[model samples]
Target: MPTALTAAYILHTLFAGVWVGAVLLATWKVVPLAKGGDLGPDALRSIESGLTTLTRLAAVVFVATGGHMAATVYGSEGLFGTGRGHLVLTMLTLWFVMTALVEVGGRRMRSALDVGKVRTAARDADAFLKAASVAGLVLLVIGGYLAGPAV
Candidate 1:
């Protein structure tokens, strides 16, 4: 049981970290560099491709591991009645919103690129992703605070 719990915990943390890191990189570095022409179209495309894949994978992991932990570990928190439960619920809500933003932005980017609207798509996607990044960052801070050592 302990081993299983440990594995789940590690996977959860790993994916969360990846999600945050990818968003931070996209929000801080990729956006500015790409906009200023410091990064080429190919580079921007490549970065977007990779980050989108990673973020999607991380979301899947988060859902699975988070659900599992919530069921097995924090199941007794009163399911949104208590403070911890409320925090978890809030994090989950933010996660859903972030996921939707990424999905919509990704689809828009793909459609724009298909129509040769590369610049427009990139700009639009950047805005959407930046919003998602901020949402993820807020979720990260809240989750960390909720799961702090003191907790």
Candidate 2:
């Protein structure tokens, strides 16, 4: 049977995959629409709504699974004990903060979209995407480290 830590690792890996996938999907779909030509008020609003919904769902899954994984893996000592632990904790912190910002920005964009304010919504969405991308990259690095042999 898998240990708690092993289970946590699997859960964390799944959450990270979903989180990164959502961000990339939105970036691919929306960025081109924004750049290709003006998406206009209606199309942009629709895009914003769809992205906001997708992001919120992804965030919920990430937070729930990640919290459980963190508790199992880090426990009382936190993720700061050894070098690997410290690196994991630092990366997690960065991703958490960035994800929070993305949530806030996503909410703002949703509101703007509701009002048919395409430009404002697009701006907020852009900010959210950028932050999410950075978070994803950090997560990827942390995952790579976790997969490597212990020193």
Task: Please state every model's RMSD to the true fold in angstroms.
Answer: 2.3, 3.1
True-structure lDDT of candidate 1: 0.77
lDDT tens string, model 1, 1-151?
A: 4676678778998888788788778777876765565666666667778877987888788878888888876785555567788888888899888888877777766666567555666677787888898888898898789667635
Report lDDT (Cα) of residue 6, candidate 2: 72
Q: Model-by-model lDDT, in order? A: 0.77, 0.69
Error of 2 at 140 (Å): 1.6
Alpha carbon lDDT of residue 9, candidate 1?
A: 79
Error of 1 at 69 (Å): 0.6
Write model 2 residue lDDT over 79-144, tens digit each, in one string. 656677677677768777767766776677678777867667767677667777777877887877
Candidate 2: the clashing residue pairs are none
Worst 10 residues of 2 by lDDT: 28-37
